[model samples]
Target: MADIKAVLPGDVMDTGAAARDGAVLRLGPGLVQADERTSAAAAGVLHSDGDLWWVAGNRRRYVAAEGEPVVGVVVARHGEGYRVDIGSAHDALLPLLAFEGATKRNKPSLAIGTVVYGRVVVANSFMDPEIECYNSHTGKSEGYGELAGGFMFKCTLGLARRLIGSTAPVLAALGSELPFEIAIGVNGRVWVHAEGPEKTVLAANAIRNSEYLDAKQCRQMVKELLAR
Candidate 1:
């Protein structure tokens, strides 16, 4: 598990993280590399995950980072690609051929307002970020594609991350009660689908309510929800 601690702007981070075998350290959001040192650029919880370090804040607006999965809404069609809003300052470009087995003549015909699950392939300050609906390593969709049905809701980025963790208790608790499918985006969007609209809404609400609950609390909450 990663060690997480609260930090404020300008706080100096452990320099030893960058000194290991002269390996360059990867900085995530709210972190910046200074002259031979790493420091916090925003107020948030600092997280250290191996060679990758980041500070997670409570801001609703998302700053795109490469390799992060996101759920975006198609806003417009631009040339050979579609522009998608991923709750960031700039819309990301999703090329028509970015999908698995896609071609120029046969591409995904997504209409405006369609929700898509993708990964940020190119993220930087100079240009609009680029996203893709296929995993580059396996050349497969791998759950990265259009989200056709169900419901989508926004949560804090922190909650979204927690929901996607391998040991998320809320998901397990809900799963024990009823069958459902979920797609979580690191950018704060969660899509849930169940057998019916009522069950779907119940699952969504349960997850949303589990944000601050402990594991036992989550299970109990789910139990109470199912009973009612």
Candidate 2:
């Protein structure tokens, strides 16, 4: 793992390690290549995963990428697919045959406003994005499907990623005091549920307010929420 640091636009990233390994580097958002050099295109933290680099910041809207899991809401059914709103500029397509056990004779019937957790299968600038609720190779739902009976809300993409990542302190802090089920999508959608509606509301509010808090601060915030 490389040490990440804050970067500003036009700042060149040190890719000496990747160059030494003769690896082709993949640049993620907020970076661009010019004059045979890669430089930051936006102000944010720079991160590297071996030969890949990306920047993380507080992004509210989503730009679909292949294989990234996202939560979507069904808006319309057209032919063999459903149009879903994933907080992206274009509506994503959720195909009927893309589910784990779906068939032409038995397609998944999703009504308008139904919430779902799925993965982006195809995304392009000129075409509509496509999402699926099942793993193509394993042919299993694998936690990707319709979400029922929960409150769904949107957050910054940076916060959503943190909630889904391993070092999510806000979730851990709240989990210690209450039991809840949460589904986080990288596209900024979050669905939360608990044993009761009041607990669920509390949990959701705690998460909603934890965007800028550190681990210790998040714990204190959760404690205060519990007290209330």
The candidate that achieves the highest lDDT relative to the unseen native structure: 1
Model 1 alpha-carbon drift over 4 Å, by segment: 15-25, 34-36
lDDT of 2 by residue, 1-228 (tens): 477899998899888878999999877566777788999877889877667687776555787777778999999999879999999999999999999999889888999999999998887668999999989979999999999997998888888867876657999998899889888888999999898888888898999999988999999999988898
Query: Per-residue error at 17 for model 2, in Å?
Result: 4.0
Per-residue C-alpha lDDT of model 1 across residues 82-130, encoded as one tens digit per residue: 9999999999999999999998888889999999999999988799999
TM-score of each: 0.91, 0.85
Give the clashing pairs for model 1: none
Query: Pairs clashing in candidate 2?
Result: none
**Which run of 10 residues does model 1 get worst, by summed lDDT?**
15-24
Stretch of 10 with least lDDT, candidate 2: 52-61
- Give the CA lDDT, 0 to 100, for residue 10 in model 2: 89
lDDT, model 1, position 174: 93
**Global local distance difference test of model 1:** 0.88
Model 2's number of clashes is: 0
